[model samples]
Target: MATLVLAACGTDAAAPADRDDVGARVFAANCATCHGPDLGGTDRGPPLLHEYYLPDHHPDVVFATAIANGVQAHHWDFGPMPAIGGLSDDEVAAVVAHVRDEQRRAGLME
Candidate 1:
């Protein structure tokens, strides 16, 4: 797992106040094992905070699709990702929101 520590800013204009807590909880429960608590890559998955994951390249829809159907390894050498079952659409959306928030916090996205 790759660990990335970024300096936190006082405020993030892009983060939704309502979604933040839900997103964080959802991500921590389901994604943190592989994606890390900070969205950094774990031994099991690639980092979501990288430039390759910036919204311009990987849109919100792409995330939803990936979570529902799984994604073949294209960027990282971590191998193919399996579909994550048992997550509702809302949960998936919250996870994406959390990841995007972390990305912005890391300055990987605007």
Candidate 2:
């Protein structure tokens, strides 16, 4: 018997890569629904752009974990952040970057 090898499909089959744009889109899609378009917090979500949270402390990691596993971590004190398992790691990276950038611009970075 002879073996059969299958070649991979065209690159078009893969999803487009746009970390920054995707991050913004993702935030607008999933987060903005609760966090607001400016990330200024909403009636449901807590403020993530001010002194309430410190980005330098471990924001990127914390944000990633919270998104991946839901906000059952210590953030419940503020409000329950629903889990967004639909967001990929890269999307999370973009959100974190956007938050960091905003924090820096606001002089809230520690």
Candidate 3:
């Protein structure tokens, strides 16, 4: 399979085997468009950095389901989040990890 390693900041994101930050790469490739580079809400979707996603409020598993099955618009007017395709389980986990880490950094969770 031919995979492209597209990078924006890091200088060592050339070889896929050399990647140490899989979550960041995955987010950039998938969720960055709607979630923004910083995970802040954009015109398309709500920010993953919001307090609504606290570990107690929305568990990590919820993210996994949403990614696979898509989510309805309950909090914003962005409408339903259609299921994103072509990602492996590990890749989905990586994206979840990335979002959770950013949420913690933003003080949305303890």
The local distance difference test score of each candidate is 0.74, 0.61, 0.71
User: In candidate 3, what are the lDDT values of residues 1-110, reduced to their tens digit?
Assistant: 11111112123333433232677898898888898999987899888888787778777677877887898988789999888789776666667767777776787766
Q: Please give each candidate's TM-score.
A: 0.81, 0.70, 0.79
Evaluated with lDDT, which candidate comes out highest? 1
**Worst 10 contiguous positions by lDDT, candidate 1:** 1-10
Candidate 1 residue 1 C-alpha distance from true site, Å: 30
Q: What order do you get sorting by lDDT, best first?
A: 1, 3, 2
RMSD of each: 8.8, 9.8, 7.8
lDDT of 1 by residue, 42-97 (tens): 99998898888887898777777787788999999988888888876666776777
The segments of candidate 2 whose C-alpha lies over 4 angstroms from its true place after superposition are 1-18, 73-78
45, model 3: CA deviation in Å?
A: 0.5
Which residue ranges in model 1 land beyond 4 Å of their true spot?
1-15
Off by over 4 Å in 3: 1-20
| Per-residue accuracy of model 2 over 1-110 as CA lDDT, tens digit each | 00100011112232434444666788888888777788788777776776656755654666766666676535535566767866655566666666666677677864
Look at candidate 1 and tell me the lDDT of residue 24: 93
